[model samples]
Target chain A: MQQNEENDNPPLFKSWKGMYWLVLGALIFQIILYYAITRYFE
Target chain B: MSYIDWFVLLGTVVFITVYGIWKTRGTQNIEGYLKGNNSEKWWTICLSIMATQASAITFLSTPGQAYEDGMRFLQFYFGLPIAMVIICVTFIPIYYKLKVYTAYEFLESRFDLKTRSLAAFLFLVQRGLAAGITIYAPAIILSTILGWNINLTNICVGALVIAYTVSGGTKAVSATQKQQMAVMMGGMIIAGIVVVHMLPAQVSFGDAVQVAGEMGKLNLVNFDFSWTDRYNVWSGVTAGLFLFMSYFGTDQSQVARYLSGKSISEIRTGLLFNGLLKIPMQFIILFIGVMVFVFYQFVQPPLYFNKVETDKLANTEQAAQFRELEVKHQQNFQAKSEQVQVMVNALQAGNDTNVETARQSLNSIQEEGKSIRKEVKDLLKKANPNTEARDTDYVFISFVMQYMPVGLIGLLMAVIICAAMSSTSSELNALASTSLIDIYRRSVKKEASEKHYLNMSRLLTFAWGVLAIFFATLASRMENLIQAVNILGSIFYGTILGIFVVAFYFKYVKSNAVFWAAVLAELIVIATYVQTDIGFLWLNPIGCLLVIFFGFMFQVLFGRKLEPVEIGIEKPLKSGK
Candidate 1:
């Protein structure tokens, strides 16, 4: 089936855990910057 | 503006409409009318999807958004690429496998007719209002800037879209969007460049960025975990993901874009293209606002950019207060302008301490101006009590009208108009498709000929177009263009996305479970939205999860499997009289 063809291909993304961590890190960094600007800088 | 600029504006519209209609002449069958016969290549689908998402508000308000809130709004899209991957893996293949024209068509197969109707109805209500806003947003900008009648602008914009859409259907919509996207991108790039060029000779691009950064306008990321904070990291990931999933994954306006692809791979490629391009495109657009912020630091801008409100205020007794505020604004601008120049020189000379001092000074002055504007608006409201106040939404339109060169001004206007039309035409087409296929064809007339359906579709398309225009006239009272449309979407998309998710993965949950769960979830979502003041984006995830969670519980308690409902995909089980 054509659905299986998608499975045969290397997934568009892999390692959901790693992906989650990467996004988390970016989010953390962004929040830190937001804090610096809003709460601390001025 | 010069006569040539008006000529350019009118010429672009007439030429593009004639071009799209001439190219997409034949839309004979329902498939052709709805999905463009699945004949479109990847790029056409890509452009169509991009154009659909990039409504008029994105152009007119995004820069103003950045001007007010900084670039943190870009974080709201951090989850977009991830959502695209999820949709590609799960949603795309299922819809392709089903060969469904509308996304809700699969709901009946997996659950019941009520579930399908429920999902489809949610989409129609959300998308229909969104279409109104899409048309209304750009028309408001044009009417405010050009001093044209708002009603006339709404009707003209709505009628122009219905003409091409009713004539050529989805094929015309897709084909025209490719050109619209091209024109929009080109016009925006030109505008950005011209904004930089029009900046005072002393301020270079680097200098502008530095000034903007100092003023806290270059802030692009926010990692805060607060649920109520609209554009923070947590909201962007959790809530924003659900919004994107529902918007791209299940909404027929978007699904229909990919449904027109020549092959499954083409659709996947189209979606992936959007996934990769959407964030960067938004960043660039918002960055234009960042640049506008820097530009305004050098130039004296209007105290309130919305002409209608400003005009009314001018005639009021508060005019003196407003004039005083403008004088204070100019004085503050002058002070900040000198500091920016000094900072630029210091940065060039590698004096970090001087740059830091200059940055602090600029930031403090900006805050002072903001506080002063707030006081001024309060004073105005206090004076008149019923006068319209707040005009941050008018900043970008005011900038274009005041600064952009002649022909380019017209082109920028065309870009916005094209965005309005591009999104509205798709909505009108999708609304008509759902109305006919999900409601009329399935429930009202099951054995209609292809010709009958085609005529009915066109008629429905025209009817919805007029309905949107009527709604657009009423949408004038809504505050914040992007937030208003999104609030409308968040009210519905989550429930619809949940229905599809359950159909795809929650196999044990029976039809009755999902149907009742969806109804209950929708009621809960609406009630929660009304009762709370949480950020609108979070509602998307909350709505979807509520339905999924409730559906499981409903099935566990019911014991007996619910009857699966048919949705007229096959021959009628019992012939109608």
Candidate 2:
């Protein structure tokens, strides 16, 4: 019964674009933070 | 080291184990036993993924890696985000659609039985050795800090994790991983913050980072193109992609984490989240190490952090020489620490010339310290041949013990235990699943009922857990736990990932060709690894590419005139009727 139900539903996935954007933003944040802390904060 | 700390550490672990078992109770069949009935939410999957990757060694040795090598190691993970996207698009859909118990199970459907068995066997070998290092890494920290025997600590850490894993299976593994992640992250954040706090009152967090930067420890990104250089943009992007793909895309340890997700979306989200989170998580861990490097500039660090060897040297004829080096090291650190403060002030004033001068002075002092430390290490080796001369892995734990408050010390210790349990439990769970589904049920007892298979999985979990503990007892003689685990993986992951890549994309490749090719490629890869001094990271790509190239060559030479076998993907969770 459970297996049948799982099979019937198309797997739920979020927007790949959204995931990409979030990841890119995170990368930028890390770079900037790392730079700002080490370079300018001193 | 206090009773209060032990209480907190023991209580945290015991509670997590009990809670996990309670939450994951009623796992009656193989599905629940291995993949948690594919009913796990995204958060559960996310935490489980993180827990599996962040071993005790990450907690114990990463700071030391940062302190010694600087933050250049961070570049090694630069390819992970890209690797995640590739796995989600390529690997996830295949596993989800095929519904396989182990990732290797897909190989059988795509190619042949030999291929499936080959992949599973490789994963077992890699993860088996990895589990030992995970347990051994944290046990070293505990035994070192508390002055206990390493073997007993290894047994204790290994047994505690195995106890819970044997009882609760994948469900318990996932549930406890969530708790462990929480504790591990909390402890790390606290530890990072406390390191900043423990610095001399004159040194702000900015000053600490500035000092570290001046000492050349903040070099997070290097665009160098060298295969021999272990952590660089070229190696990280190309070779690192293959390594991550092989590890997350093909290995059962990671495959099983996503397999437990309630839906395809949840698994996808969990993986994508991991892709987003993992690089930064590693960065923070490495950053903590960077901060530690700065902290030591103001404080006089041990000439050698490895107590076992340091103690031996203390009783030797060379003890006076080592003491002289220690005194020289103290004077050098004092001068450099003062110079670093001046450098920070100059940088703050936007004076590039003074900044450059300060940097050079800091570098010269650092060079002198390195020589003295090397002298001490040589004395240690002369005093005790069996002792490790490198103590980079012990730096963070040493800081925690000497600096942190009592309550927080316990919390950080719990974090190490949690990290150990997180990775160890995942390994045990994966090993049990592979043994039962891929080997036992597939080859040994094909006619067993679901209940029987489930029982077998539990038994295998206990058996593998015991095996891991036995391996952990022998893990102490290793040089560095984190690198040792990765080196072990590099030995097998490439060929395993290679077989999967062929199974997925190379349609004309027959199972017999791929199987023989994989075997030969594995041997060649191992031979190259042992004979060469190339950085270990390169092995991942080398092993993988060798399998594909060899598999194709074998197909062209030996696969002609033989009828191709029909490869049908099987439902992994559902027992074949």
Candidate 3:
């Protein structure tokens, strides 16, 4: 059976946790931006 | 279309197809064919996953959806990033450790063969139907707008996909997707920029956006909560999360893409990349549609965007009445155009009061225009009962054909076809892989040689392509192509996701409990979909929670000590432990 040895290091982020947080942050930023667009344009 | 346009369209599509087949030649083994030799890097996996999900309908109907419904559609993807993180943490490592070809293979190891087969069968049913829609959607729209035969268009798209998919399998699907995604996004961005440029010279990009906002087309985020309201913050975050979890975690079409990654880390990277980028890409596409809405405010759009149906009514006895409606539509457009100018001037002058007044007048005229358009649609349906009365899907394509420069038109058409082929190729590849690995090889041909299985994989790929084309012929009855695809997936995805959720968690709930639990849960989900007005996204969480709930109930009641079957592999890691 083939086994995948886990690699903890990502290319850019300090850790996978960091990457996940970054993605979450991006989502929050986008939602905020869209909400701002809605309000500003309104 | 001009000769130059034909050349560009044919040149781009043929180049990509030939490149995919040529690059992936000499794939003779089942692993190489089905799993792309497990050699794919994160970038290939990223593009392949995104390409498979985008599909032709995403390119064709989404902009039009935004054009008609506003950017609220974007909220539908808000949960994707969260789902990506969850799958990366849980699903990726498990699948890689297990070395499974299909997601259902994990179910069999964790639960039982009946459970695996049930999940695989549901996938085949839903994905098979969706594969046809993937081909039919762009075919119907391109055929109508470009005056091509719909059947021939369907066959052409299906055959192009089958050619490469059957020849080189998953590798070919991934190889071609890079180019397909490039062309699809590049063409869209170009279209977006061009649409803005095509706006009246006096209307700056900001002005166009402000006009769209004033017309209520920029409603990107709605914080309000309603169970039946499809795209809102609550539904998008909670229900959308479950839907994405099921789709990326359990669906073989997506699972197969990442399963080809060279390492678990690479797969995780690929999925996370998609999660981070998918929403913004959708925003650009939807923003383009809003810009088109603004563009049409200055120009007189057709009374009906679907020329095929509208043209059919042109020679009928209803033609006179239709002409009257057309005349009224033009008058409405003229009046709305003037009001838009008033709003734009007020906006430019920085007078909030005048801007508000002009905005109100413009919105009222827009309402009158909508009523006239509705009457035209009603008349068209009365004139021909078979007409697809919904024209939102045609809005963007109509704009492209009537206004875009000739060669770019060809590029845009290629973009649509490329999207169709990229997604269909992935579907056929996944469908064949799941069918061969989970069903055929496991049940009927357990002792087949590698060469024999490889041959069967190719044969099955071709067979699924044919079946998809057959289904495409009957797809006309469905409403808006994008919504139809999502609706069909929702009907089954929740139950399938539930089975996987159980297989991962709830260790004490044995196969007997979950197998029957899944059966009951799927039936209930389907019943809910057919009988209720609950939003489709809600089905994912509903179906999954129901499975977990019932599995526990069954285990508590039955208390059966059935011995677990050893499938000649390492036992899966108990999820939490």
Residue pairs that clash (backbone atoms under 3 angstroms), model 3:
none
Per-structure clash totals for the candidates: 2, 2, 0
Higher TM-score: candidate 1 or 3? 3
TM-score of chain A of each: 0.52, 0.57, 0.75
lDDT of 2 by residue, B395-436 (tens): 888888888899888898899889989999989999999988
> What DockQ does each listed candidate score?
0.13, 0.24, 0.58
Collision pairs in model 1: A30-B223, A31-B223
TM-score of 1: 0.91
lDDT of 1 by residue, B1-577 (tens): 6787888777887777888788889777888888788788778988999999898888988989988888888888877877877887788877787777788877776766888788888788878888888888788778877888888989988988999999999999998899899989999998999889988886778777766776777666665488678877678777888989988988888888888887777777677667667777887899898888888877877766776776677787888888888889888888978988888889788898998998888779888888877877797787767655667668888898888888998898888888888999899999998898888987889887899999999999999999999989888765555466677788888888888888777777877888888889888988988999877787788888998999989988884864443333433222111
Worst 10 residues of 3 chain B by lDDT: B568-577
lDDT of 2: 0.80
Best by TM-score: 3
Interface RMSD of each: 6.0, 5.0, 2.3
Q: What are the lDDT figures for the candidates, one per model? A: 0.80, 0.80, 0.88
lDDT for position B99 in model 3: 81
Q: What TM-score do all the candidates reach, one by one?
A: 0.91, 0.93, 0.96
Q: What is the Å distance of residue B233 in model 1 from its true position?
A: 1.7
lDDT for B526 in candidate 1 is 84
